[model samples]
Target: MPPKPGVIPLGPLRLGDIFNGAFATVGRHAKQLFGVGAAVYGGALAVVAATIAIAYAATADHLDRIFALSGDEDPRSEDWVPLLVAFCAIVLVCLVAAAISTAMMYAAVPVVLQEAVLGRPTTFSAVWQRAWTRVPAVIGTVFLTWVIAMVPILLAWAGVVALVIGVVSMDGGDGVSVTLVVIGILGALATAPLAVWLWVKFSLAPSAVVFENQGPVAALRRSSLLVRGDWWRIFGISLLAGAVAGTASYLIQLPFSFIGMFSGALGSANLSDDPNPTSVIVAMSGYALAMVIGQLVSQLIVATFPPLVTGLLYVDRRIRTEDLGPVLAEAAAVPPQYTG
Candidate 1:
């Protein structure tokens, strides 16, 4: 009912308002959102690619030996060690790159939203610089939240593993594995709700980090305050946003996957029975490129939309609990050039 100046009414918002605001933010700031996202993720991808290339170069001999092994001739330690080390190194590099990229995007969204809420325009350079400044704090918040949420998932995995072991060792009369399975299952079930609760409670931390310029722990405590009393509403909306983003990402990637599959099949049809590495690379290049493009697109959606929703939720909570609407409206009335 309030004056609609920006993405949402400068007041407490409903579920529809939050969702629409998120979409509006993306539409208005696509250049900054997608542009910075592409730069960050593209740079990460390049780093990962460089790492893989270097690793492959170093372990090329071991890889050749691996491929040279006959049907029944198992590889020796020398044949596996170099490749294993390279694989572990590559994995470590990937994880580091992904963490940094994700943290940057998370920081960037709230920066964009800060302007979006006030109907002010922002640029890619502004978002990029501000986001980069906050990346370390965002990384801390994201890592802590992830560790909290993963508790239930890890417990469930342990339960599954214990169940598998129990089934495999059923002939042993001690029944110890059965007891372990039961304990794991119960422990996982008991902790799952706690994990979900903690996750939602801290969901607004990244936004707080950027909006309030708070450190990770302070931002988390701030999120706990804002999300206090409205846990279910925040939880449901967050869940819906995540589901929507995930589905869209998957749908967007489907066509690329099909194209890659068909093109790879066609290309491989021309390969000889004992084709060399060059030929194999050429044949599979289309598939690799398509998959890469698909993954990039998917990552863009995953990185952008949910954070937008969460950022809006952070604004909504402030409007509701802290009476932030008039402040936002006042900001919206100012010319973009006049205000910082």
Candidate 2:
């Protein structure tokens, strides 16, 4: 393909081109993307870090109750209040942060990519202004997707329940129950692939909403239309992108992984010697910080890369099926007609 004036080529893209384009998209728009990243993921990481610190503090506070158990007191039987508080804190933080990150990042990336394709530089403010228009559609699309993806699992679970109920009502013995368990296992296995296929079927939804200016319901239909005969192509590209991105993230996180490993080892070793709460807290702190850093980097990769690939897939599908390149080019070329 000849070089185009944009971050990505105007023609249909190869896998290498898609991945390279994702990198180029970020490289060309680092300030804007990173600013968006800082706004979306940075806040979440802060919440996680604060919540984890509180959780650790809770564990440290309850350690005395755990260690002070005498012959009469069983440590297992004791209710650890602080630790329970910590677990709840962590869960709450994760739930809130996950909801925010999932909704907004999906909205933001496609908006910027659309601008990139149009041969315009986008600012963080401009991206946010445009992206906000698609958030409701993005959220609805995501919810619908989750519901669709759950169909297989839900059907499998229903089968298991029906089998158990029928067997119990008929006074069937252990052998029948064991047979039902095997059936449930096979049902789950078969449905897992179906679930993944269904996901790929609707994976281009955000792009449809953003680039094609479709509503939530319309976006779902548009995504299905675009992916109609090309499910395998999208699936293969997605898998390859995942493999490359996952490997890069793992290598980038290796140093932090090593620090976490060493910290865990030190904490475990301390259990045999002094076994003090301070040593446990110190080790746990190191491990927690390392894990947080790793998570942030992983999230940044996810925010930057996967959407770019998905956006490219969306564009490639449109170019092939609908002759989208000329339409986009024509729109970019023609000035707005004014009668006033």
Candidate 3:
């Protein structure tokens, strides 16, 4: 609280104030945030790029062989194995990076912001200590939210499948596929509201898990309690923050896109210069590095905003619910109570 001026005010924040404070929080703590982010996200992205590079390196020759086959010749099963292996490796890398980065983005960023809010000195070690311990619960919260958000799509898929089955069983003729299309469209239309409702209702769960140290289920309940009667405001702020974050991320990432395009153009031009594999590898590596840089910068900005704003919203809810600002202001000066 000693450095309290730029810290969010310890009272109910309007949409305007919340956004203002959200930006302020990012600005005030950008150094620590980005430092922590670099380690967590940078490694994950490197894995992605490395996987892609490896796949390309591993399969390039096999792909060339498949393409070089004579007009009358077909590829053998062995010709497909390299492609298959590369595809599986890419998928595997993606899944692992996704799992690691989700917790780092949602759980880790909020933990850092909460420490700042509590007026504690934030170091990478301190932030990681808090967030790393809660990684499991944070990931569970993420998993639960995704499952909930995908309910509509899953339902539509099921409905489509069921409709097809019934149509086949009944020997329904030409119109069955048309009926499936209609049901799918209706299901999509109906899913929007349901997904938005669930999303807003549980949006604060990640913040609850970090700041309140609640488990996934209890964090869900905590968010529901805090979000009661303020659903619209939360939704509005979330939408606005999403727009701002998306725009900022796009702008930050725009140059990298240009770099990608330029590298690609450069690569395309160079491809005709030589039929040699070494030149091709060099060009491909350059393109891959460009993409990796773009993604890393994109992740930095993209990952910061949502959790920061959501954490502020959690603070706003607490101020309204229990007058939490004064206590948090004193957070660094006091020891935590553990009566529960």
Whole-model Cα lDDT of every candidate shown, in order: 0.90, 0.79, 0.79
Per-residue lDDT of 97 in model 3: 86
Which residue runs does candidate 1 get wrong by more than 4 Å? 152-174, 276-278, 337-340
Position 333, candidate 3: lDDT? 64
Instruction: Residues 110-214, candidate 2: write the lDDT tens digits.
Output: 877876665667777877777777777888898898789879978997989799889988999888988998888889888999889889999999889888778
* Best candidate (score: lDDT): 1
- State in Å the error of residue 323, model 1: 0.4
Residue 207 local lDDT, model 2: 88
Candidate 1 lDDT, 1-340, residue by residue in tens = 7877878998789999999999999999999999999999999999999998898779877887788789999999987988889999999999999999999999999999998888888888788888999999999998888897878869786766867676677764446666666777787778888889999999999999999999998999999999999999999999999999999999999999999999899999999998766578789989998999999999999999999999999999999999999988888889765212
Give the count of colliding residue pairs in each prediction.
Answer: 0, 0, 0
lDDT of 3 by residue, 81-116 (tens): 879989998999899788877786787778767656
TM-score of each: 0.91, 0.83, 0.89
- Alpha carbon deviation, residue 332, candidate 1 (Å): 2.2
Give the Å error, residue 253, model 1: 0.8
Name the candidate that leads on TM-score: 1
Clashes in model 2: which pairs?
none
Clashing residue pairs in candidate 3 are none
